[model samples]
Target chain A: ELKVEQNPLFLSMQEGKNYTIYCNYSTTSARLYWYRQDPGKSLESLFVLLSNGAVKQEGRLMASLDTKARLSTLHITAAVHDLSATYFCAVDQGRSGSRLTFGEGTQLTVNP
Target chain B: GAGVSQTPSNKVTEKGKYVELRCDPISGHTALYWYRQSLGQGPEFLIYFQGTGAADDSGLPNDRFFAVRPEGSVSTLKIQRTERGDSAVYLCASSLNAANTGELFFGEGSRLTVL
Candidate 1:
């Protein structure tokens, strides 16, 4: 079984501060995904990291993958209250159809 | 549909009852996935379908949980003899790539509560 662990499961940040959420997996995977979920809403894809050193950024959020280290990171820059949501990182099992194993999500609160 | 669609947005049923959840994936998406999310937890994989066949069902916790995508566009998840532990938001996602490399677009999810 593939295990995924995330640190700082609950995060609270003031406006203009920056923080990073880390995801560590137990096995090798070809794809890593970052997702954001608001309360009672669906998970929305934020970034898709396909390679060992792949990095993607959107607005104030950035994500990167390190396949060799079996780690992925989601960084928030100049955080704002609108950025508050539960974030998750999922790793695809080395198989078809993208069977994903997700880590316990990090709930972020950006306060003004 | 503009996005993955799921039916029965919220369901409340008695324990031991059977329930069915439906998912309508985006048009032209070849891959579909099902996941379960407990309160305050990330979604856990339940099954994945490539076209009309299920390519992977290893994430299913038991035999009572089953899913099928007969025509390759819409899928249904069936649960038999449901227990309280089965209560969760069942999420459906779709991807355009068969190799599982594409970004997954998720549905709003069907929230199931077993009383």
Candidate 2:
């Protein structure tokens, strides 16, 4: 079974602070995805990291993948109040099955 | 619709009743996935459909949960004799293909409550 663990499940950070959410997977995988969800809403895709050392950034958020270590990170740079939400990292275990094993998720609360 | 759509945005039912949830994937998407999310937890994969056939259903908890994508576009998930533990948000997602590289687009989800 593939297991995914995330650190500091609950995070409360003030606006303009920087933080990183870590996602560690138990098995090897070809791709990792970062998603954000607000209360009562579905997930919104943040980044798709496909290869080792792949990094993608948008606005105040950035995501990177290290396949060898079986880890991915979502970094928030200078967070804003509107950025408060739960962030999830999912791993595609290099199988054709298209099943995604997701981390427990990091609930971020950005205080203004 | 511009993105994936799920029916019955919210459902409230008593235990032992049967319920059906619907999903309409984005146009041209060849893969559809069903997931369940409990409060404070991430979504758990329930099933995956490639075209009109289910490519994988291993994540399904039991026979009580079954899904079908008969037309290769629209899909329905049926629950037989629901339980309080079955109450959760049912999310439907679609991807361009069944490949690992494809990114998933999710629906708002159907929040099911079993009393």
Candidate 3:
């Protein structure tokens, strides 16, 4: 069974500060994804890391994948109140159907 | 619909009652998936369908939970003898083609409350 774990389940950071959310998986899959969910809303895609050493950045959010270590990280640079939400990392099993195992998620709260 | 659509945005049922949730995939999507999200938890895969066939239903908790994608466009999830543990948000997702590794798009989800 593939397991995905994320650190700092609950995070409280002040605006303009920086933080990083870590995602570690138990399998050898190379495809990983990051999603963000607002309160009472569905998830939206953030980043798709397709291979080793792949990194993607949008705005203040950057995500990287290290397949060899079975890990991925979502780094927030200069966080803002709008960035506060629940973020999840999902690892694709890389099978025909691409079954995804997701981490528990990190709930971020940005305070001014 | 422009995105994946799930019916009965919220459903409240008594214990042991039957519940059914529906999902409508994108117009051209060939792959659909079902997932369950409990309070303060990530979505867990419940099943996957390729067209009209269920390619993988391994994540289903038990036999009491069943899903069918008749005609391949719309899918229905049936739960029998529901328990309090079944209370959670059921999410539906769809993709253009699983073989091509298309990005999965998720619905807003149907929140089920088994009281």
Give interface RMSD (Å), model 3. 1.1
Fnat values, candidates in order: 0.82, 0.70, 0.66
| For model 1 chain B, the run of ten residues with the poorest summed lDDT | B95-104
Cα lDDT of model 2 by residue, A70-108, tens digit: 889999999999999999999887678568888999999
Q: Write down the worst ten-residue block by lDDT for model 3 chain B.
A: B95-104
Tens-digit lDDT track for model 3 on B1-115?
8999999999999999999999999899999999999999999999999999999999999999999999999999999999999999999999888976546899999999999
Which digits, one per residue and each the tens of the lDDT, describe model 2 over residues B12-31? 99999999999999999999
Please, what are the lDDT tens digits per residue for candidate 3 over residues A1-112? 7899999899999999999999999988658999999999999989988889999999999999999999899999999999989999998978888688889999999998
TM-score of every prediction relative to native? 0.97, 0.98, 0.98
Give per-residue lDDT, candidate 3, residue B46: 98
Task: Estimate how well candidate 1 is docked, as a DockQ score.
Answer: 0.82
Order of the predicted models by DockQ, top scorer first: 1, 2, 3
Structure candidate 2, residue pairs in collision: none
Off by over 4 Å in 2: none
| Backbone clashes in model 1, listed as residue pairs | none
TM-score of 3: 0.98
* lDDT string, candidate 1, B1-115, tens digits: 8999999999999999999999999999999999999999999989989899998898899999999999999999999999999999999999997675668999999999999
True contacts kept of 1: 0.82
Each candidate: chain B TM-score = 0.97, 0.98, 0.98
